[model samples]
Target: SQQGEEDPQALSIQEGENATMNCSYKTSINNLQWYRQNSGRGLVHLILIRSNEREKHSGRLRVTLDTSKKSSSLLITASRAADTASYFCATRGPPGYSTLTFGKGTMLLVSP
Candidate 1:
């Protein structure tokens, strides 16, 4: 079952602006990952934060996880028009398993 759901189904912003998206899950997870997808392309892994980690960063992306709240948020700084895409959050089950449940995704539009 898919455990994660992202809020703000769609968002629009101008270039150089920042974009933020939040995800909430229903069950415990070993780790949470964020991915990005262009119009019709495959998803690109952005970043992953372990269960014990509170935050992680990569490039212009920043992610924060709160196990107690079963939620996470992804923030993109100084966004660009090229950054327009659909972002999804995925949750992985415990160690012995390799299953991943993905959210419907949040569509972001970064206009120039």
Candidate 2:
């Protein structure tokens, strides 16, 4: 079954602005991960926040996880036109499950 669903079907912003996207999941998860996809390219893993960790940052990316709410948010600071892409969140189900379920994704457009 699908586990994660991202909020905001789409987003549009200018370069240098900040873009934030959210994801909500249905089941308990061991960890949540964010990824970015450029056009037809493969997804690029951005950051992974474990259940035990509430927040994490990687370069221009910030991620926050609220286990009780079964939600997570991703923030991209100083966005650029190159940052235009689709963002997806993935969740790792409880133990014994080897696969991760990904959300539908939020399509972001950063205009120059």
Candidate 3:
């Protein structure tokens, strides 16, 4: 089974600070992707790291994956109130499977 679970169900921080979240999964995966969702909106793709990759970055987002440990982490640098949202980690199984298993997500609240 493919499953991903995120840690620290919730996080609170002030604007300009940093927020970090972790995810762990069961079974092998081809790639791991991170997404962000506003309170009443669809999820937005953030970044993705392949199994062969150890790290990846996009703008203010940084992601690290450790296949050996079956884990991944997301780091948001220079947080903002507008950045407050739910962050989720999703995993895609081998090539033939187009489905993605998403984690419960971590709610991040940023105050100005």
Candidate 4:
């Protein structure tokens, strides 16, 4: 079954501003990963912080996890037009199979 779901189906932002998106999961998981999809390109791995980790940051990306709430948030600091894309969150099971289940992403548009 599908596990993760990102909030805000679509977002429009001005260049140089910030963008924030939230994700919610349904089941107990080993880890949650975030990826960025551009137009017709493959998803680019953004970040993968495990269940034990509460928060992580990578350059302009900041991720926060709240296991109690089964939710996570991604914050993009100083956004740009090039950042316009779809962001998805995936949940990885704890068992032997490491397949990732993805959610319907949030389509972000950054105006130049």
Candidate 5:
């Protein structure tokens, strides 16, 4: 079994600042997705980028993928206190397999 590994295990920032996290995986993937989890809460899906796509964005989020390097990055612009959470990257296995492996996570803290 393979999994994604997130970087910068922890982070701290002030409100209105920006936050960025990176994820790396060992195997080929169908798609890579980002998520946000508040303390003791369920994960919230943020964005998804296919292996063939180089970049994607959703609102304040910017995601980039480099298949050749087997890595991806997530950037949150104008981050707010509410944006403080653990960000993660999930990798979906190829076509038929029903496996979705999640990276450990990058913790982002935004103070008011």
Candidate 6:
């Protein structure tokens, strides 16, 4: 499967703390996207950094791509209670079945 596996299946942090998640894949990919989904809701696109890029950031989120290692990491700074959600990494694979494959995700719980 052209899917990435994320680490720390679950996480809990205080509102003022930061949270970090990691994702690792087995195959080559064209791009990787980060998404956040609230409980029982669809995922919301957070960031997309192409294979050629090394790092990308949006607001309180920072993403890093290391194609050589076939891994990516997401960091959320100064997290708020509202920022609590599941984080997933989807990979855009090459050749057939290029559709994005999602990781199991890391459930983030931000305590107020």
By lDDT, who's the top model here?
1
Q: Please, what is the TM-score per model?
A: 0.97, 0.97, 0.96, 0.96, 0.96, 0.94
Question: Model 2: clashing residue pairs?
Answer: none
Those runs of model 1 whose alpha carbons end farther than 4 Å from true positions after fitting are: none
Task: Pull out the clashing pairs in model 6.
Answer: none
Model 3 poorest 10 in a row by lDDT: 1-10
Q: Write the per-residue lDDT of candidate 6 for residues 34-107, one digit (tens) a residue.
A: 99999989999999989899999899999999999999999999999999899999999865656999999999
Candidate 6: Cα lDDT at 66 = 99
lDDT of 4 by residue, 34-54 (tens): 999999999999999899999
| Deviation (Å) of 97 in candidate 4 | 3.5
The lDDT of each candidate is 0.96, 0.94, 0.95, 0.94, 0.93, 0.94
Measured on C-alpha atoms, candidate 5 has an lDDT of 0.93
Task: Write candidate 1's Cα lDDT for 1-112 as tens digits.
Answer: 6699998899999999999999999988999999999998999999999999999989999999999999999999999999999999999988988988999999999999
Q: Report how far off residue 82 is in candidate 2 (Å).
A: 0.6
Task: Report how far residue 39 has shifted in candidate 2, in Å.
Answer: 0.8
Better candidate by TM-score, 1 or 4: 1
Leading candidate by TM-score: 1
> lDDT by residue for model 5 over 1-112, one digit each (tens)?
4489999899999998889899999988999999999999999999999988999999999999999999999999999999999999999978887678999999999999
**Would you list the rank order by TM-score, best first?**
1, 2, 3, 4, 5, 6
The predicted structure with the larger TM-score, 4 or 6, is 4
Q: How much lDDT does candidate 3 score?
A: 0.95
Q: Residue 81 deviation, candidate 3, in Å?
A: 0.5
